[model samples]
Target: MGTQQTTQDKYYVVVAGDTLSGIASRFRTTVKQLQIWNNISDPNIIKVGQRLLVAKATAGEPQPGDPSFVPFPGGEWFKTLPTSPIIEMMGLRLVEEGCGAAYGFSGPGPKWNDKHRQAYACFQSALGYSGSDADGWPGRKSWDQLRVPFPEEGCDAQ
Candidate 1:
């Protein structure tokens, strides 16, 4: 019987000194699993900023956050809003739709990661945007589609 590799329900980003073997060990996954998850043709090579799917996603995990999930003081959602758990929650919904990279979400704080970018692209594509429109960024249509809460009272659905 072939031994099965185990992984977590999250994603891991490659850092400056990360190795496939090291990552596999850190996530308790096998190098082969990492290769398959990230489609690495060469296990010996991985970029520092590359995202790796180290685990399987949970059933209905990390869905888009409700209006109350905002980690900030007020729910001021909008295009180019500061990063927060709200963004991470949207990323989860993207994963459920299968546009999420095999990897998972990261930087639920004031930063961005490849995982989110890929998922954002998926969201944009799903919204019928193509060419440059599909670039991995947010818009009112997507915010409504993804159910991101309003940042202010005057902001109506576009």
Candidate 2:
């Protein structure tokens, strides 16, 4: 929005086929608000997987971009060849939770692969999710519970 950034803000990760107006409608906010919140001068310039502030955070929400706050990138994000620090952060968190013991050849790297999925499934199972819920795809609830640490200082997450 401005040089003075708001520390606490709610975020939404953009996904395929999303338009600025569509996102605004989905979040029940105005496109103008989205622009102001994200400092987006061109409404059509948003890219897939981009994170946008949808609203101001209420009490108890974590600060935006802080290590304690990680927004849920949609499940579709994992299907793609993601290379963000967030992926590595998630892998480490899963391993910490005892889900990534067999991380295959490269170990817990920054790309999405079967290893990550398998480990995530293990985490989900530990959390008591089963059937379709424990399919290794990260849902909002499971993701929030995972608590992937924010990327190290100076390392931006996608």
Candidate 3:
């Protein structure tokens, strides 16, 4: 009889502060595959001492630099907006033309009135402005601030 060759599966012990994405990258496998193999419903929920089965590389698998799997450099430097196309579309308009324009829909303002100023403050807060709201209306400093990850060109989108 001929001798048979056996391949043993490799396993990894999960450590504290280990994330599924981090572990999957280290093992050269996709998070989806690891989840499927181990019947994990939530990739984000992993515990220390969990045993992970490392799968062998497969054909047509995504490479490290593949667009879908690639880690964006400086990604952490920017914040992602919540998904709401309607909000994005409308919010962009409000940001562009809502409060800061001359006689815009945000309320007629050479300088905003109390109500107008309150609305402006809310808008500023929504846009992630971190400065004091005591002054209400956005000033030179507010315009210089990078709030919603988009250009704060004077609202003219009307």
- Top candidate, metric TM-score: 2
**Which candidate leads in lDDT?**
2
TM-scores, one per candidate? 0.39, 0.55, 0.33
For candidate 1, give the lDDT of residue 3. Answer: 24
Model 1 residue 23 distance off true place after TM-score fit, in angstroms = 37
All candidates: CA RMSD in angstroms?
Answer: 13.4, 16.2, 17.4
Candidate 1's C-alpha runs over 4 A off are: 1-82, 102-110, 149-158
Model 2 alpha-carbon drift over 4 Å, by segment: 1-67, 104-106, 154-158
lDDT score of residue 93 within candidate 3: 30
Question: What ranking of all candidate models by lDDT puts the best one first?
Answer: 2, 1, 3
Q: Residues 1-158, candidate 3: write the lDDT tens digits.
A: 11112255567889999887667545544566578778899978999999988654334433333322213223221122223222232233333333434234643322224544454465566546756753454443333231222222322211
Tell how far residue 103 is off in model 1, in angstroms.
2.8
Error of 1 at 117 (Å): 1.6
